[model samples]
Target: MEDGFNIGDIVLSKMGRDSGRHYIVVSTDENYVFICDGDYHKVAKPKKKKMKHVEATGSRSEYVAGKIAEEAKTTNTELRRAIAEFEGTENVPVQQDEM
Candidate 1:
């Protein structure tokens, strides 16, 4: 069960009522990952999902990643925009760092 999940990475739910819904990876553990959509799943209360239950989308958010790596603060609005930017559903610009 190689999760291959990283903070700020985008993922898709594979096995649950939320299946097909895209979310952002906020945190991870040995066996599970915490995700937030910034709506139903807020950063204040992310959803804990099994690693195998999610499929990595190969997309990442540098802004959120930077905050986590720096131990700085991350907000739900940022998360929501990140998701929207990835899904191309919104025109909100996501600040991404070139790493």
Candidate 2:
């Protein structure tokens, strides 16, 4: 965790095709981490990216972290909610365009 990143931590893709997109860290090992947005990169198949390619958001989902710590399976819905909440965009109200 010295790198300020851990499983379930929120991160931003700093490089590559997914650059600028936010994702959750699903797993990590040495210099690489597996991440997912719960949409394109589902939990079943996360993107393996180098640690340097991501920037930690200093936020984490305890529920996701706990589940992963226990080696439990997580669903896309749960992950999506966690990320939305982390980014403070959960339950966003739909805006109507003025005529």
Query: Who wins the lDDT comparison?
Result: 1
Per-model lDDT = 0.86, 0.84
Worst 10 residues of 1 by lDDT: 90-99
Model 1 bad stretches (over 4 Å): 92-99
How displaced is residue 41 in candidate 1, in Å?
0.6
TM-score of each: 0.86, 0.85
Tens-place lDDT per residue, model 2, 10-87, is 999999989998999988888899998887788888999999999988888999999989988787777888888987
What is the TM-score (0 to 1) of candidate 1? 0.86
Clash count in backbone of candidate 2: 0
Per-residue CA lDDT of model 1 for 5-54, tens digit only, reads: 89999998999999999999889999999999877787778999999999
